[model samples]
Target: MTSFNTIIIQNIVESLNVGLMVISHEGKIIFLNKAAGAILDLDCEQHLGFGWGELFITDEKSNAQFNQVILDVISQQKVGLKHIASYTLKDSTCPKKLSITSSYLTEDDATLGMVFLFEDITEIFNAEEREKKILSRNAALQKERIEGLDSLSQAVAHQVLNPVTVIGGMANIISRKLPEGDPLIHDVQVISEEALKLEGLVAAVHSYCDIPKPIPVVVSAKALFEEANKSANEILDRIGECIEMKLDCTVDKITVGKKLFHTAIVELLLNASNFTMEKITDVSVKVSRSENIITIKIADHGMGIEKHLLPHVLDPFFSTKAKGVGMGLSRVKKIVFEHQGTLQIESPGSGKGTTVTIELPCPDLSCCSKKNSD
Candidate 1:
């Protein structure tokens, strides 16, 4: 009756879904389920009499791992061991991943041997590896493209500057020589404006290359904005009282490049002022600071950027205006990141207005001093 019951139990175990193998008290391979035979290319009857050490062959890298697990089982290191191994079988075209769980084949707390359950996870690993390679390839391509753009911009900037200066100089000469209200005076003024726009484009490109060289200093956010506001108003008065200031920061001083950082804020303000050309537009500059980050938000109630174009706003030389240089936001983004900060641009649809938020880390004294000296 006992032998009959044992055979019935073994048959029941062999019919399960997972690959199951049982080792006897002498560490011999006593039983293997049907799933185990299929997974391991096992001739169940031939392999039943061998020890645990004579199981399926793992790859060269996993051979020592297999031995270590066996040693751990023999020494009763813990209640069980679970490991995943990939191995090639006799008739296999590719490696198969097996998630194996080995536990003591015990009854009433007595030492029996080990039982292992394995699952084939070959497809899962292959999918993960494919996704990883795709991401790596994309990152490599992006990096290569950026480096190419940087090189090309540098070469073009020098050539652009000389011609722009000459045109600007000629425009000044023509405007001075022409009489007041002359029809050609307006044309010469347009040429001056266009030349200035070109010069600004060159400067924006140069700012990208020079962002790394800023010597950080302790600067007052209040004073910075005050100066920036005055400068922006002077250069951008045509847009009316479009720029309004709101400061809500208790911490006044932040560490950054006074000149370049001021330049960054001025760029954002100018961008807002330029786009709000219709009537007297409202452009607001708000500053808020927290324990860790300082945020400067610039908002404009003007012609907002299009949704499709918004995503590429910070990209170098990206523009929507017929005569836009496309370096304003790009240079602003570069400067904000150099200060260990982030710049976020948000706009609803076209003609709804745009908001740009810049968040910067609050500077620590020792670190600020170190960076300034360096």
Candidate 2:
């Protein structure tokens, strides 16, 4: 009968998935099961008579804390459970996380040694980390989709409203000229112009929503800025100001889709021009390169963005402008991200002017040159 009971106990210990160890009163390991040996990266025979602290190495601070827990368990002569704690093995390649439950062994209510049950939780921890990353990525994608839909709606509303506004203004003007014969004629012409403007706006919205396939090529930064500035000549002249372009980058070329790059630069230029104070003499565009990053900064001396609004500027449909549809900066942000870059806006509250900085990963000139030559 005693032999039968001993066999059953051995079978139970061998079948357990959790690691098990029995420690003497002197903190020495007296018994270890196969699972415990595997966790400590040792054979059961090799682990016997070794100190628990030596088998599961921890820092001085952690060792002190764990010793206190063991003392408390021994004094109370009760079972104690501790949350999973990480331990770095001295000679193992992988870290181990374990939950330890300790209980004192007693014979006729007199204390003897203690038994520790160790459960490895490393795989559970890794799965939780992976799940967190997946959730984070899904959240970001959902936010982008919602923002895109909102921008589309705003663009449509702006397109519809622009023509209606133009037509209304023309109707008011022609009301006084009704007696001059062709009263409705001027209104009709105005409506046609307004309709064309709306069509152009709608086209911009379509292009923004359905991005074209990328045609990657090396584009000259200096040449692109020069062309964009020239296109904005009329606006500069009307505003009685000059845009100063400071090109400090040695790497003149970047790999990008030419048309999209051109549009991004133009949009930034237009934004700068529109936002500058009339008395401000210059809008500065500075280009520089450092390490493997290319940076472009556009600064305007205008009534700067409000401090509270700066955080939300890149959000779709969020605008400080009285008349804007608020998609310009949002579109710029999207384009910069597509190019593996970041866009940041800095301002000192309301009256201090604003600066928009764009940083893009620099292209490998060697590879680009080889491709171009080929």
Query: Could you tell me the lDDT of residue 234 within candidate 2?
Result: 53
Q: Model 2: per-residue lDDT, tens digit, 125-203?
A: 8899899999779858965885677576657767676666676566566666567666576766666566655655555
Task: Mark the regions of model 1 whose C-alpha exceeds 4 Å error after superposition.
Answer: 1-17, 56-76, 79-81, 91-93, 105-110, 177-184, 209-315, 319-324, 328-374
lDDT scores in order: 0.78, 0.72
- RMSD in Å for model 2: 16.1
RMSD to the hidden true structure, all candidates:
9.3, 16.1
The number of the candidate with the highest lDDT is 1
Assess candidate 2 and give its lDDT. Answer: 0.72
TM-score per candidate: 0.59, 0.50
Candidate 1 weakest ten by summed lDDT: 56-65
